[model samples]
Target: MKDFKFVSKTQETLKIALINFALLLIFVELGSLGWYFVKHKQFFYTREKTQNKSDLGINLEGVRLNQSIVERFHPFFGFIQQPSADFRPGFKVNNYGFISPYDYPFKKNKKNQFIIGIFGGSVASDYSIFQIQNKILPQYLKQLPGLQDKEFVILSFATGGYKQPQQLLILNYFLALGQELDMVVNIDGFNEVALSNLNNKNQINLAMPSIQHILPLTSLANNSLSTKAMQTTLRIQENKTKINQGLESLQHCSFAACDALTSVYVQNLVNNYRKDVVAFEKERGQNQQDDEGSVIYINKNKSVLEDSAAFEQMAWNWAKSSIFMHKVLSASNVPYFQVLQPNQYYQTKRVFGEAEKRIAFNNETPYAKAVELGYPALLSKLPNLQKNNINILNGVNVFDKTKDAVYVDSCCHYNKAGEVVFSNYVGSSILESLRKDEARSKKK
Candidate 1:
């Protein structure tokens, strides 16, 4: 009888333990639900730092920020980088549709104020915003002769994937807005040679803006409608976005359960998902359409005669556009220099450091052949440009002698050292040109 009593007591204890455990789970879930209803945010969250591993040439956040960035077209200048904050730290798009912290268009142009405007594609934009503003303007350029008494203001009217006449159009657009400049620096050639065909040619008119700026608008206009593979991509993109949301809320997460390591793992999985999606889209021949409602043309005044762009025509357009820009700027007494930007495929002209070999090149890039074949066409136009009295600098060989790691990525961008090198050369040219002008004026 005593043994039976002991068994009964043990059964009661086990039943009570199970019941308590169930009640505890219910309590936690109910509390979590209550928290969500009050805050309108997920209770469980995590943190992660993003690494760009895809060669999409654009980040997903940039694509999704349609109103402020690309995926929208401007009627005047093909497309403008609408003034808005970018994801990069300390990046602010000024009111003039350029990347700058200050609204230079409205900033009081002081006496002896020297406004140096940069025009081109991504390289020029990066050079203007980062290198010129941070290093060259302060350390190198400001120390130049004839600039000692002048207060410098920078205007970076460049955009990503910009080519020839687009830079010309940007200058005209801003000048029409009554913006003034003491000097203009245009870094171009690569986009003219490479993206002209990539962005246009069988896709849109060769004269239109970069296709990077086009497809997104079409996708948005179609209301996310796409092929099955693209649908999968869209789903994964949404998942990545949600993951990013949770990743963003880590510091503010009230729950003690926000796991940083788990967040990184989740992000990595999504990154791989993105890679798979890309491959799947390619395999399935996922249709990327230029929908009927998607095309917006901006070759007003019809400067471009060709329906499709070839290498020679693109180089011609580049030369003519620079010639026109120099004429316009020269009329206003603004010195202009056209710089052909640096590219990695051209790295064969010089020996690259181990670091450059590791990070700066991808043989698989679509631009490799285009650069090899198309760059020669651009180079051929140099004598014609010089004949027009347009100040021209062939910067294709800028990294020819540098054993230092200069290029930043597989694309045509540069690192700090590269930016410094590019700026130093530009500064030297500016000094020489100013001295020559002074001499000419004295002789007159």
Candidate 2:
């Protein structure tokens, strides 16, 4: 009986010990969770605020919600104007569409003629003196004998770093505002792939953070992190300062020791930027097909159009956006033309430097592949466009390297000389098209 009693007591003690251990574990877990919440409260709050302040609708004018100010202006001179000369540098917001600044507002006349608007990135926005003097298509068109009375307004609406979806958004915005346009010309290639990877879908709706606002905080934090890490690492090394000073001396110590230390420290910060980018892309969704059977990569949030199916959904999105502009102009009985700009690599493959070659392949060359896949898919849909009487001015042929061309570096943004060449080509094409239309009208 004593043995039985002893066994029972031992079992009871074991059970009690096990219960205490389990309780301890539970308490530790809860405490850890609570600590984490306390430590990251500000991060959570800021994320929540950003989410809550999400855009209600698309901003057509590229106005920022917080500042309620216009960062850029669309002037009659075919150039984007900054707020003021004294305003902060790099404050201009370029267009978010396929429109270019290659053309300017002209004196209106009673000739019920077609007015073509050109749009795209910097290639379309080439308004340098060289371009104006030699390559501006509008200038050439104005002087053409065939298009004497036919006015062609090549208003460029392309902005740097704008992607396909943003261009569509801009077209939709302008259409809503009831701007009568005849046709749209797009010179796209460089920004399509790169900006597609960024996370700024609502750029037009929100105010871009100022460079001045970011620089000071970044400098201070960088300095603090470097100072702490360096002090910790060099605490015991007697010759550490000597080595560091020698390295600094090699560069003439242009920056103070503290600055270098700060840079090293700040660069080590582990950020969730990659995670945020992934989340944004997932939210944007896949590309859609266009009327041309081309699969266009669209931000999955937008609407789909027929015949745009075969183009890379992103490319298709951009093309569809351009097509949408054409529809708007057609509805308003405004005439316009669309031009597909060539990637810079296609224009200057021979002169590319090592780094330039890599960037050309990674950044600009993919459009050619997209076009190859898109063209066959879109071939059948050409008739539908013809039915709409939309004159498609395909400039992809101009990208042929067999012909000498000038582009800015290895990217699609053309240099002054290149812009002039492209503009002249565009002008010639417009004149020919107008002459054909005149003949057709006479025959009718």
Candidate 3:
């Protein structure tokens, strides 16, 4: 009888334990649901819409895009152009990894195909190679008589954030690859001027290292995640707003404290989510600091160290590079022209509209002072550029006399009207040079 009583007591203890365990689980589920309701205020919530990775258009070399379809990596100049990246409408990368719609290995059916390669920075890479071929340069060229029937293939190697050396490297690549280019036109100034000023403190050259190497703080994967997190945060804020609106419409069961509590809770959740983002950015910044070898940031204790010498040296380097390019093209029997593109920073004249004025004179950027210090140095080398028999178009004062707005932005990126003006000048220059070449050829 005593053994039976002990067994019965063991059964009773097991039952009590099971009952308590079930109660604990029920409470946990209730708490989770309550937390969810507090945070979202809705019984059900839909996920926020996000941009597809393919939607982000192409950016090459040191330039970056929010979304990318980058596939190939180049050893020398960082990333190569992504072929057939149709991320945006009317934009296509050709098979040769250029921002062109036409297949490369140009069809040699047309003997008089006047192939010209254009190289520069963001200005050149504004849209795509196709844009230049079909729209920009062609629009101006068509207007000039006798250029209508010429089969022209304008190969663009311009990339945003690229500098002089980078542009030269791209030209060298195509030339080395046995790609036939008749004339090469380079349009640049802003990137050279801006990069030199910004990176001088780093003691690095005007051109940046590879995009991956330069921005090592955040990986592409992490950047995507950060973007999604921001989207989610926006969704959460929207939900909170909706919840507040709904609360105001309710008749009420003494919900003042509850309303306050819910608002505080949602805001706290939002704050906490934001804290994670801040932490991620901080970590990335720390990583960037750690990888300073690639970036080369030398902190000089300069209360007052003028960048005049640096600017002079940088401009000298630019001139020397230009001279070298002149030799390369001359040896190859290819005509070359370098256009010293204008910048809004140096334009003291009222060339900017209301919007352009804001972009040009924004003191937040250091381009103003850089242009002030660097353009003079660049101008000083024009005599040397002229002496070397290098064909150059000094566009620094191209818009000085014009009344219409020339620059669309402070960085001196041109608008359609601006492009028409610039391209017309460039086209006229090319035609004049070609005529001179033909005359020289006939004399020979």
Candidate RMSDs in order: 9.3, 22.4, 15.3
Better of 1 and 3 by TM-score: 1
- Tell me the tens digit of each residue's lDDT in model 2 across 1-444: 999999999999999999998997667555544543454343222222222111111111111222211123222212133322221122222233122232223223546554544456555555322332344555656564555566454444554444454455556656565544556665554454333322223211111221112222222333422343233333313223333333333233222232234333322221122222223223222211121332211123233222233244445455566567677666666566666565543332345445544433444333454444444433434455556676766665554433443543433555444565666667688778877877887899
lDDT of 1 by residue, 218-328 (tens): 555566434554566566666656555545554344543233333445456456554554444333332254444544333322243343246777788889999999999
Best by TM-score: 1
User: What lDDT does candidate 1 reach at residue 224?
Assistant: 44
Residue 56 in candidate 3 has what lDDT?
15
lDDT of each: 0.66, 0.42, 0.59
Deviation in Å, model 3, residue 186 alpha carbon: 0.7
Worst 10 residues of 2 by lDDT: 53-62
Off by over 4 Å in 3: 1-73, 79-84, 87-90, 94-97, 103-109, 127-148, 207-213, 216-287, 292-306, 348-350, 437-444
Clashing pairs in 1: none
Best by lDDT: 1
